[model samples]
Target: MDSQTGTHDDNMKPATKKSLRGFAAMDPQRQREIASLGGRAAHQSGHAHEFTSEEARAAGKKRHARAQATGESPRA
Candidate 1:
């Protein structure tokens, strides 16, 4: 039973066991190494974009304006 929600434990569905496949199966260190390799490859191939401070500020301002107009929260 959930003390806060006042729900009976038996009414809840039992948790199922799931096998972690592909990237999800990897350990954190292995994942970081794989991601690092991809990032390095992208930069070496000139496919990666590094934003300037001014550009980042402009993008943030634009995002804020769009969010304000749409009555949605701005992303951090």
Candidate 2:
């Protein structure tokens, strides 16, 4: 992060930044497109997990139970 501006540093040299960029500088649509492509590639490469229907349902039920018990968002 930039100290004076209190913002992420986006003015990095090309050599330093060739592999990554300040995500805040990316347009939302472009970010989504890139993220979607990465997700598809991960699944194609067998590197990403896909939940079974039963697993998803169980997870959702657990989340709801947690929320009910805590009175806060399950995600929190």
Candidate 3:
């Protein structure tokens, strides 16, 4: 379960395995509001730290190596 939003556990399920039927059931305005609220919340929580392009590339390489060793992609 998503502790942050009380939504279904998307992390536990593969993206391709999930259906968008429920997502389409929601109001577009409501969805936009929810996404905007989440973005603001994340910004307020100091979660959007800055990372230079070089740093990001280095991190990606390290993450790829780790994923290869563990047989799983690294989480965002």
lDDT of 1 by residue, 1-76 (tens): 6999977788688779999999999999999999999999999999999999999999999999999999999974
Higher-scoring candidate on lDDT, 1 or 2? 1
Global CA lDDT computed for model 1: 0.94
What would the per-residue lDDT of candidate 2 be over residues 11-75, giving only the tens digit for each residue? 76445555556876799998999999999999999999989999999999999998999899877
Q: lDDT scores for all predictions?
A: 0.94, 0.87, 0.84
Lowest lDDT block of 10, candidate 3: 14-23
Task: By TM-score, rank the candidates, best first.
Answer: 1, 2, 3
TM-score result, candidate 1: 0.75
Q: Candidate 3 local accuracy as lDDT?
A: 0.84
Off by over 4 Å in 2: 1-21, 73-76
Name the TM-score of candidate 2: 0.57
User: What ranking of all candidate models by lDDT puts the best one first?
Assistant: 1, 2, 3
lDDT of 3 at 1: 66
Model 3 per-residue lDDT tens digits across residues 1-76 = 6889878875596457655676576899988988899888988999976789999999999999999998896874
Model 1: number of backbone collisions? 0
